[model samples]
Target: WTIAQVKAVAQAYGESAAMLLDGLDSGEPVGALAAKMQEAVFYVGDAEYRCLADIGERAHDVSGLEFVALREGSRWKVYPVESAPGGDYFVVEQILIRPRDAPESSPVIAIVDDDPLLTAEMCSYFHSHGYIARPYNTEATFRAALGENVFDGFIVDWLLETGTAEAIIQSIRQSRHGDAPILLLTGKLVTGEANEDEVARVIQQYDVKPFEKPAR
Candidate 1:
């Protein structure tokens, strides 16, 4: 393909085919650019002929810029074929890539509290705000959940039916998701204060509140 052709199509797609070529010129890995071309290009050949065709097509841009490879002595060689019609290809000279919106990713929120009613309340709140909510009633269940999924944020009770919230928060901080936001809810002022000092130190944020059973 011609340099002008590559630049034209890239411009039509709002991408910088020329800039990509420039990046490749700088000796950078073309993997990312190649991947993007896989999405934009309408057709892609099978594995055997894919790379050669793409490179061959791109090697020729303007009429005179011939693809060259040295064999022996002082002579250079050029392939007989011209620009391949398909597979991932880019035009690298100098162009601009227009900014585009990124794909949407939903945030997840995890709730760790012994009270079923409280779990429901907190889950409902997060869900209403467009977050995917997961609830756990015990330390074991919360730990198990972490082994399977990652959360954007977490809400742990000040006191569990079987263990202290501090211990659970500490364990969470040590997990792969240790840096995730954790909001601790508690009815006792002292526990809240203590958590706010040490355990809550690692928490992104926390809330203290009195618990009331939900009405049927």
Candidate 2:
């Protein structure tokens, strides 16, 4: 990861902690606050477990709180101390540092598109060509997978059901796989769903190669 990427992650952690603190001060339940943070994707890896514990004599669980970051097998356990106005709350943030599956000999590609048929066909095509292709029908699932797995390349449709693929592209560029090849797939240019200038800007901004739909 680049220095900027590292700093960005750190900033996110700080922001998450602040958010948690604010929520607690505002009388929000710890579990609810944690759930919100989890949904916000502050931690990078797969969240193994997240819970609230008392810092007082009620629990006194200090097993891994001393260290800033702990490596457990393929995951990293992080403890971000939060001093809520109510008291101190032990916040355990577990992020998976590596993919659960063993590294593949062939390139692993992620295809993100809302169209089930297109996603399936692309996955099948890549699989036949010796690439391990994973298909996601929505941006949410693709983002979820990003935290759990590493991909050698990405093929994302320019437009998704929820929104444009700009956020997804930006995420890939900012992630550990910053140099990974990204191919933007879209039929919108021909269909008038997206303008040429918009498409060109995204392609140049992320340095991604653009492939028109029905790529042959």
The per-candidate count of clashes, in order, stands at: 4, 2
For model 2, how does the per-residue alpha-carbon lDDT over 1-216 read when each residue is reduced to its tens digit?
575665676687775434443543567675665554321112323453332222222224545553133333433234443311233333443332222343367789999989899889988777645578999998889889988888999999988888789999999999888899999988878778978898899999899999987796
TM-score of 2: 0.52
lDDT of 1 at 38: 20
lDDT of 1 at 161: 74
Give the worst 10-residue stretch by lDDT in candidate 2. Answer: 50-59
Q: What do the candidate models score in CA lDDT, each in turn?
A: 0.54, 0.67
Candidate 1 per-residue C-alpha lDDT over 1-216 given as tens digits, one digit per residue, 9 for 90 to 100: 688898898898899886656654655455644543321111113321112112223433444543222222322222322534333233323222223223235688888888888788878766544567888988888888887887877877766777567667767777887777776666654534334454444343333322322312
| Per-model TM values vs. the true structure | 0.42, 0.52
Quick one: best lDDT, which candidate? Answer: 2
Residue pairs of candidate 1 with colliding backbone atoms: 1-83, 3-61, 21-92, 57-83
CA RMSD of each candidate after superposition: 19.0, 19.9
Error of 1 at 94 (Å): 44
